[model samples]
Target: MSTTSGAAGAAYDVAIVGTGGIAAIHARDLAELGERARIVTAVDTDAGRLDDFSRRWSVPRTYAALESMLEFERPDVVVLCTPPGLHTGQALTCLEHGVTVLCEKPPALSLAEMDTIIGAERADAGDGRFATVFQHRFGSGAESLRRLVGDPRLGPPMTAVCHTLWYRPDDYFAAPWRGVWGVEGGGPTMGHGIHQMDLLLSVLGPWRDVSAVAARRARPTDTEDFSAALVTFDSGVVATVVNSLLSPRETSYLRFDFAHATVELEHLYGYDDASWRVSAAPEHEDTVAAAWAEGPKGRGSGHAAQYTALFDALDAGAPPPVTTADARDTMELVAAIYASSFTGQTVRRGDLGPGSPFYDRMNGDGAPWAAAKETEVPA
Candidate 1:
């Protein structure tokens, strides 16, 4: 509603398609940036939300559908804040119209859905760029770690661990699509665990194999609210992922162990940022055991912090930290976890590796997660 005009570049003008909780974060960044960008148009399937959006931001353009927004507003960038299942279709639509997209994480449900969009992007030169927000890489702790990744002191990360705990009220799942099998896909893993998982991969590199388990143990939804996964990177690093909405308390953490040192990000915000610790190894067993003290909690909810970095990156014209291809890697891990849980098997990273048939799975009707999902959520 209240935005300055005059965007000059191909990626300058922006539109936000969803007006939910997460969308507000993106909107705030664009709004504060003033003339740096414009929230050209707002859109939602329900339509009533647009009035609130208009009043809040003084936004002038609103549309009920994404295509109509694109047709009328002609923005250069579109930030997708829709639900997880809608990511692929909406992203592909924006790309077709020469709009760069920065969708939220777990970009697609299965390797198959991911493939449809990734394939089209690879083939179309000017369809526009795509990225997902894996903003942990931009966090203060991560920024420090990336700078030293290749240094002799922190060289060759050997392992990583991620833990995320948050409170999710029952009403949070009142939205019909919040915890469905076909729609939301998985629970905390896709919705919650993904942020930590993506951070681990960014630090350790691509995964070579993964073993995982997922279940709908705590929530009423069809998808899982809790999950844990083990990832082995091609670079020989091992990592662990744990995400849960069942926790009464909220905490978030990611730690990496390198050849000579350890790096970590820990905070009270479940999906947000916190303080970081980098330290050397202890020489003696007793000394190491004595040093098992509590660490610092994170400072800000990673939401606003991440947006600061994302908007800065976009302004600089440098590509964001996590691109569409990178987002697919995170989803592959999610898929592998679901597959492993369903089939009681270890999923090879190569099975969904580059050029694998899994990426091209259009309908994704036969996914292992699907088979495992056949059993209804317990009453």
Candidate 2:
């Protein structure tokens, strides 16, 4: 296996695959990382896009395929900004090549695929690690919230709310893969809401079970445009999650109602310390206020912050941030949401495995609306 190790203070080589919108973000963040990382190579099927990205980002090398990049560049890490369907295979390839991968969200379409990637990472030992981009968890606001969750002053988590109510017009789905089940996976729940839900899981720990409902609603898509669920965490914290792609006024919000305080975060896509607010209970107001004030600060949730943490882990020879194991629970929650929505049954943490249909695909028994849409004759 190739080694990720280098002399201390040496910048890790990073090759970004897929020079799309999100890949640009990864490139920008790597540029911001300065000496910690260097974007030595770029890979994309679109030659025009590849050349443009390489020139714009000042990347020294380019390739038409990941295999060619891995064979030649063999960078320490590869940032995968490819489609959901491509993540599993690309990640596995990176692992085989002994290159760490920091993949975009909805890392895989199903729990089974994520498990396979995790298994591959395990086999690689210290050679390569897989981390997912759940940027919300790296922000100081989230850091403070996590610390407070365990502090005696915050008390226990009682209930919570997580919403990813964003709009996507008809034109947004013009891309052939935008709303497809096989390629993009499970619509808003899997793609959009998974971010907030991941942050929720990051703070609350493992979830116990979930009961959900989903519908295609007002979009031309194979998957649900919206979904809602009632999730119960292992700590008995109950939370309501809503993911929608039809809301006119877009918003990403989360509220944690603890015994001592009601912690809330109001933001659109990303959040910082200013996006959060704390309302301490009357009795514990002074202590809770003081504790919250003294917690971590400054860092905001975004690709740059997450990359910073990731580099730190790589530098220390530890597992990268949002390790496949760390992200497995969130991915499981996503699968549970889809499973519960489709099967009309509460799906628990351990309920999905090799035999379960949801284990392999988000649309377990096929979305109920898919058949209806199929039966309808073209107008």
Candidate 3:
């Protein structure tokens, strides 16, 4: 998978496996790099996706599996674009061969599974970094929101909520792997909500406790169509999160109420779209507006932001945009919610931290460590 620059990319720095839905984004972003980022090889279980990817990206080689591609390509970076369940094993393969990986979210089916890859990364910590796809972090407006959180003058966020209300056609879940617990893992929360959930976790860190309820109210998906949770942060911030593939009209939004101001992240999660609004409370609204006229605030969304960050890191020999440690925290949050909802209790974040029950459980196997609940994702 050696590469020479013709056009579209500066030099070859990485290989991408799994040329599926998200792979297109990686390819397009690399192409747009205009000689900055290149895809050395594209591996896929589907020969057809490889064919399309090769013609589209001007990539030189394609493989049906990671081993062949890793040995053949020996690229500096590998992207795990496969489904969440396949990440743990594939990432380990890439890491063992000295390839850095930018894996998509829910990096492994379980925290235990991710440990295998994380363990390797720890051993090789200074060697190369493993990153997860919590791409929403790159959104243009997100940085502005972060600044807002740190400003005490803006007041503390009293409440925050994330909503992923979107439409999923019957055919969307027609793929057995999608709706099936074994292959896909969890429902809307696990599969779709993970990204926004990461954003939530980023804004409200150290979630102290969580209580959740999940149910498959609509859709044939084996997992829940809808799930809701109430979380308490170690910072004393409270959050309510709800996600679903069951809604008719699509709506994706995040909002927070601070003592002096209110910030609402609207349309931040719908595919190919987003918007946000931030204002001071009525009493402080005027003063905030006066300060706001000083400048504009916001960030990027989706593959556009993520792909650029991922490639730039690979090019400079820097760490990927979102680290594996970031992913672990997000997954632990999900695990806590699942545990709380499934066990009929509230889950504390410390329970999933180092030396906790879930810390060493994964041992990095891609195979399912725990069976999916015939009902909801496990706690």
Query: For each candidate, how many residue pairs have backbone atoms clashing (under 3 Å)?
Result: 8, 0, 14
Query: What are the Cα lDDT values of the candidates?
Result: 0.70, 0.89, 0.72
Better of 1 and 3 by TM-score: 3
**Tens digit of per-residue lDDT, candidate 2, span 279-351:** 9989999999999998888998889899888877876788889989877888888889999998889988899
TM-score for each predicted model, relative to the true structure:
0.82, 0.96, 0.86
Candidate 1: how many backbone clashes? 8
The window of 10 residues in a row where model 1 has the poorest summed lDDT is: 288-297
How many clashing pairs does model 3 include?
Answer: 14
> lDDT tens string, model 1, 1-379?
1233335322256788888877877777666555656677888887677778767887788889999887777776788889888988998998887677888776777777777877877766674778786666565556545556666644578888888887787898999998876787767877787787777777666788878776667667777777777878888877888888998878877888876677677775333232665567764333322332322224243544554555566656765546767887788877777666655678887576546433443113344444566865877
Worst 10 residues of 2 by lDDT: 1-10
Error of 2 at 196 (Å): 0.5
Q: Write the per-residue lDDT of candidate 3 for residues 1-379, one digit (tens) a residue.
A: 2355534333656688888878887777666665556677788888887898888878888888889876767776787888777888888877777677888766887777766777998787345668887877876566556656757656777889888887787789877688666677677777888888888888767788989877766677666677899989988888899988978887777888888887777773533223766677777877665544443344357665776677656656677778877887888877776666656678887676555443443211121222334436657
Q: Give the TM-score of candidate 1.
A: 0.82
